[model samples]
Target: MTTDLLSLKARWADLRQQQPQSRIRDAAQQLGVSEAELLVTGLGETVTRLTGDFRELLKQVTSLGYVMALTRNDVLVHERKGVYEKVSFSNHVGLVLGPDIDLRLFMNRWQWGFAVQENGRKSLQFFDPQGQAVHKMYLTDRSDEIAYNRLVTRFQDSQQSTELAILPAAAKEIEKDDTDIDVSGFRHGWLDMKDTHEFFSLLRQYGVGRQQGLRLAPEGHAQLLSMEVLKRIFAEAADRQVSIMVFVSNPGCIQIHTGPVHKLATMGPWFNVLDPTFNLHLNETRVDQVWLTRKPTTDGIVTGLELFDKDGQNVALIFGERKPGKPELTSWRTLVDDITAAAIS
Candidate 1:
């Protein structure tokens, strides 16, 4: 169906009046349009098309003092509140390293940008070619409003069209049968894993995808788990004050949260970490599979709880926080052991 801006604006107004608290992304889906398309319709009113160099603009975000960086996929939203510090870029890869506002950006996937205002709230939102939000920066009361205005004015796209061209979602890679892989070689590589980073290369060498690799691994290496495992892991970590790393990614970027998470709740289809500096809203309903995976690393056996969606896309990765030259945390390893034993029993 074709989208008409005037009609869509009217429809959006009616919908907003009916459900004042719904998010724009949700409302856009309900209206059968892309979220970026919906935001484009507000071009002259509440949205300003942004242009100039995205990288340059990102480099200057540090001037804003304190802001919130948000990245998500279909099932998870990761938000970090702090100043954008230590910004650097190498080709299409970008990094924001600091105690807060950490990010890994595949810069080339950033396709669209907008400066939006609603009910006196403002933010800089960016999207990929397929209309998936790659990242967002929101100004807080402590942020430098003057810096934000300067950057917006400097980079405002000359076109500012009220129409958007959103590409369709890419098809998922087809899963391969275990019989298609060299089982003996795959097993040998699994046994030889010297670090978590080596798993990717092993998958490449075995001509298999990540999920396929797990499925093909020997029974003792990877075991499928129930959704209940996630709930218990969070509760157990909170109770024990364990620092864990939660990795969530989009096609264009991966956002990592490292520290202790205590405020966790599940409401309807969403699992939330309603913390002060970091917030994660994960969609438990979209979860299709959970795997308790043990990978051999130079440090020792590294265990992680991996969640996958129906399309086989990794939804989230949960691992105990540990640096190089250290074995997995004893408590986390014990928790994994107990969970695995319980699942088997």
Candidate 2:
């Protein structure tokens, strides 16, 4: 059984190298062995069958190897050498060496001693695979430098407390599965004016603060100046003859439109704007929704202005198709003269 197991192990290793996707059952069949034997040899007996120190050793080695493998990525030799050189100067540099390379690989190549003789004539040594001393040094009984150096060296050599290794192989896998969305065609604009004094004043009364106008392309724009500004605009529009509709792109674009210019000859502090080739959404119905849904309203007037929290969410709405007959709203140049005339009145 032992000889057969060794032969099967060798055959398994060969098949694993040649046909990476070959299943265990297929490999066992190809080797003229039963699946039961293969399973027993490959995975060992079940945990219930494990007894004594051997079981404990098996558990420890398996767990330890798993942890070590998780962090054992190949680091550039030059980078490691640079770090070691920097650390060596400090008499006590904490470093951890893993199983990827023998101690001689660093000591022999770097010309650094690995073993040390501590106070009380105790000798400390590091060994390679062949049991040869990889490093050696000496320390006097009263030498604090030597003791500190020994502590640092031991700390550096142990693999405990190291973070998981991020391997290039894993990075490549992540890159292969990643995707990016294009948004080059998005555009945006904004409108601001000094003449909206009444609007600004009303905003301050209602706790609506200062504001800045923003526009996203294809007939969407909004004023993000201040929440107080929005409250006052909505409240005044509600009390007066004008009907207001504010639209916002999910990410961070806003658009506001007011209707029925009776008694008001101008566009107040309000402006027409849009974000072109930008990710934004027009919540034209949000104000309508609030009026229909909630009660007593909140602190500010619920203008239909959709507020996007950040730039990323704003991009999504900006990239979608535009609303039809959205008016040539992007042409701010033509509207500016009319807007200015109305605001002054």
Candidate that would win on lDDT:
1
Positional deviation of residue 182's Cα in model 1 after best superposition, in angstroms: 0.9
Model 2 local distance difference test score: 0.27
lDDT of each: 0.86, 0.27
Each prediction's Cα RMSD? 2.0, 27.3
True-structure lDDT of candidate 1: 0.86
- The TM-score that candidate 2 achieves is 0.17
| Per-residue lDDT of candidate 1, residues 226-323 (tens digit) | 88877887878888888888888887778788888889898988888988988999888888888889999988899998889878888789899887
Q: For residue 130, what is the lDDT in candidate 2?
A: 27
Total residue pair clashes for candidate 1: 0
Model 2 over residues 171-265: C-alpha lDDT tens digits? 21111111231112221111222222233343333332222112221232233233333333433443443433322211111121223222211
